[model samples]
Target: MKSLTLLITLLCFLTFSVFAHPPEGVWKKKLVWKEDWVQIWKTVKKEAWETKWKKVQVPVWKEIQIPVWKEEKVPDWKIVKKPLIEEREVPAWKEDKVQVWKKITKPVWKLIDVPVWKEIQVPVWKDIQVPVWKEIQVPIWKEIQVPYWKEIQVPYWKEIKVPVWKEIQVPIWKDIQVPVWKEVEVPDWKKIWVPEWVKMGIPGEKYLGKDHEGWEYTSHDLWRKKLIWKPVWKKIWRKEKKQEWKTEKKQEWVTKKVEEWKTEKKQEWRTEKKQEWRTEKKQEWITKKVQEWKTEKKQEWKTEKKQEWKQEKKLEWKDEWIQVWKPIKKQIWIKEKREKWVEEKQQIWRIEKKKVWATDKKLIWKDEWKSYQAPIWKEVKVPAWKKVWKPIWEKVWVPNSHGWD
Candidate 1:
């Protein structure tokens, strides 16, 4: 029991110690690449040649008779008509009466009215009311005051005291009762049986030789067993009490003294007087004169004369000439030609062969470099400490005229 208890206590202590603290920093993985030269198998093309059947054009020349054309001139005649113009005096116009314009002197008179304008100077006067303004000086009496700062004694916070609470750990000792098991011997009893013999007789028994006359009697010995209890002792485990002392931690409250700073406010005042000036205006009236104009017209009579022309028709006798055409026999000579064609044969083209440069594709092996990503281990930076602001009280000297009004 003691060994078991000690084993349990040791396991609990190991578990608590393992979970108390944790590991710091972080684990990181990165990818890295390395350059190296290696052999690689690749497909490449090369030029080669082999024998093959190819079609070609062959050129041949042969000569045969071909047709040739010849030209000759021949004379021919034709008949055509001729035109002539003759002038002979014949009566084509006759004398007739036609009206014509004649000029004569005549008198005409007309009465017309004409307008004439004349300008004259005339005086015009009008009565009108208009507004007029005049500037005058006005005295404006005003009392003005300006603000100024005034200093005085005022109450302000100087220092302060505050109570602070803090936590502390305390150790205490305690007594505990623990049960103990021990091996000991105890007394006990058990019962068992044994076999024993006893004498026995039968009543009214005759001679045993006669079997059938009287009652046959026989004597037999009987055996029996009895049970009894016996005391015995054995070794076993027993429980016992024991007292032990243990150490433990407890929380307690404590008080402390701390000093802090405070702020206060106050007001100030000032006054002043000044003077200013302004101006005013008024209205006035006046009279004006202007000039005017007028127009007049009159009528008069006059005489005019104009000349015109008229057309007339008359007939007179005149002479004219005419053109006439007549048919006559005349010979015209022209040149002509004759053509003939004949059958012939000629050669134009033939077949031939040529040689040229060409390329072909094939497979080969080559070596090159390739890139890939590989895993690697590297050292990286991690944050261990950080900056933080803590609250604390501090005292400083402040001036009275630091704020605005």
Candidate 2:
């Protein structure tokens, strides 16, 4: 049994030795840079990290915002030159209208000479020309006269009062309202200035580290970085009042007093001795007032409850927030080294053919790095058709048997 166990152990050891990994095959043991391998998605939707998120629109990164070459607005000669302006006169149309007056004919009575008869009292009727004598009978009509007019003497001009019209020029003065223009301040482009950093790129947080920050050419995935900055949120605190209740008992005293009043009943006229409550309400009214006071106190509690909510909100805000640090990648630095190996150990190889015993045999090439000398190629003459076409293999070099020495 002991021999059998020993044989089984030996067989097991041999089996394990055949399958063991080799210790020395270039080892391939080099510090490889773990690239910043991150697969960015709109959202990590596989698990609890799934949440509503907006896709990073990558803001058309290639929109290389090359600064617009604005043509400097140099004031041109035409713009600076003063233009000629002229004042023109407009002719006004003129027209005149003239008025003329013509004299009108009116009836006029010419009196012939009538001799005055003062003292003789004889009727003085002068008819110096009997052929031209007019009728002496005048139509005399007496009208209702005013008292003042009856007192005046007829046909005599004593002291006379006249109303005279005089031409007067009434000058007019008017008030005029004028519009005013207010001065408004406008920003001057000459005063506008931009910083060099702003001119290079849009304003954002700049990452300063040795490794690749934003863009990497080694990976097909576009690089995205997040900075978890701890925000210093502001704190606000305020105080409110807290109320306490105080109750006192004054030996439960009661006062009794009588008062008289002309208390009119529904139908009977009478006097009533009413008990006057000097301080508090009547027992029934006091009970009702106590209930009202209790209700008002509850209303105060409702107002105080709202104040508590503000404190509750402040407690809710005590939660902390986190900011992520920037991610980076290590640079790959390769160095050239000299190495020696056997013919079978050549890493790179190519397939080639050689002829042996009039048959073609494929062979793998082992090219070694070495110095070479270039020789000028020369062409040998052959048949025209043979130069155009390639000849098939016919024979091979053989030293001992089939051919050449």
The numbered model that scores best in lDDT is 1
Candidate models: Cα lDDT each: 0.34, 0.29
lDDT of 2: 0.29
**Which ranges in model 1 have alpha carbons more than 4 Å from their true place?**
1-155, 161-220, 225-230, 248-405
Candidate 2 deviant stretches above 4 angstroms: 1-167, 180-182, 186-193, 198-405
lDDT of candidate 1 over 142-198, digit per residue (tens) = 343223334543444322223244444433334444443333444444333344444
RMSD (Cα, Å) for all candidates, in order, is 59.3, 65.3
